[model samples]
Target: MRLEGVFARYGRRDAWVLQNVDGEVRQGDTIVITGRNGAGKSTLLRVLAGLLPVGRGKVRDRPDIVGWVPERFPTAQPFAVLAYLQGIARVQGLSQSLAQKTIDAWGERFFLTPFFATPLEELSKGTARKVGLIQALLNPPQLLVMDEPWEGLDAQSQAELPAVVEELTKNGGSCVLTDHRGRAADLGDVRHWQVHQGVLKEEDAPAPQEDAEHHVIEIVVRTDEVGTTVEWLREAGYDVHGTRERR
Candidate 1:
């Protein structure tokens, strides 16, 4: 979809949240939005999902179905986890058989079957976020929009999210998302966009750096063992300083 000079604001009295935001969300593409707090990142995502109407311009070619994962999952729902997601799938126009099948597939993918019967309000933030994600995918959207979807997620889920997103875009789905935890990892070429003061601009990707590059560390040795330690250090071409013990 193409954004043509889009502008948005919360209400009549509120200042504009997005200004002349021109952009594109193409198939098989991943766009990452970055910005400071209150920079309209969330607003832009909502606009992409058609949840918010732009005051000025048109978002052309927005897909028929858009899946959204808000930054925080509403945890006060009365339904069990599976029931909540199932309701979303059914509402999205999925058949009863298809909804059950898809929900179960995603539940297993996120290792969420254990919590399928658990109450929505009872799950922790991490677990609830998983449900938020599964509900979005239940209908297989053409556009997947997420806002800080990794917040409160455990290490395993955090690590798996990139793969899940990759699979979506690989299958011709478009993705737009925001992250405050630096750039995304383990994904293919990403289009990085920064929203500042309600203006959005594309940014050049940073030069790749080796995360496992060699690093130096310091060590201390006992004064009496200095001779032996120094020999070992010299043999290993390492360095250490001897320190006297306090009485």
Candidate 2:
């Protein structure tokens, strides 16, 4: 997908938030958008996600499935959390049993199962953002767009996001996201863009150190410790996987 000379604003009377922007998000691509507050980064993300129509030019070759997560999850809806997620799953083409099962698994992964049945309006900001994230992740999206996705997440949830995006890109999917907290610095080999003064600029990636060497070591811990063992690994941006040991 590509943005071609796009110009956009919130309303007819509002000043243009993005002007003559051009970019490409190709298969296996992870593009990170960054800028100071109110610098039109969010607007550019919306345009990429096809949520906001551009005032001029166009986004070409959009994917069929797009997962869009806003900066703030809206909590004014009238549905319970689980029910809302179920609806999204159905829309995303999951069967009832699959939806429930998937939701259950992700709920546990994000530590959100306790609030599964809670009303949306009653949940905290962080929890509400989890709802938005889980819905987008209910199914793999050809294009994933998240605006400030790490803003209100817990440490564990925040750690889980990069893995999700990496998996998608690994599968020839495309992702565009915003990171305001500088937490995405370790996301690994991603295209970085700055949206400033209604224009977009691509930043050059740092050159890799020729002498850098990384080693992987696996250790088995006590069963009880397994529950929390991956935290540090995830924080340090190491890939974590579970496997069965042969007898």
Model 1: per-residue Cα lDDT over 184-218, one tens digit each: 75566899999999999998885666666656665
Instruction: Score every model by TM-score.
Output: 0.82, 0.81
lDDT of 2: 0.85
C-alpha lDDT score of every prediction, in listed order = 0.84, 0.85
For residues 151-194, what per-residue lDDT tens digits would candidate 2 score against the true structure?
76767788898888888999999989888556677678799998
Q: How accurate is candidate 1 locally (lDDT)?
A: 0.84
Q: How big is the RMSD of model 1?
A: 11.0
Off by over 4 Å in 1: 207-247
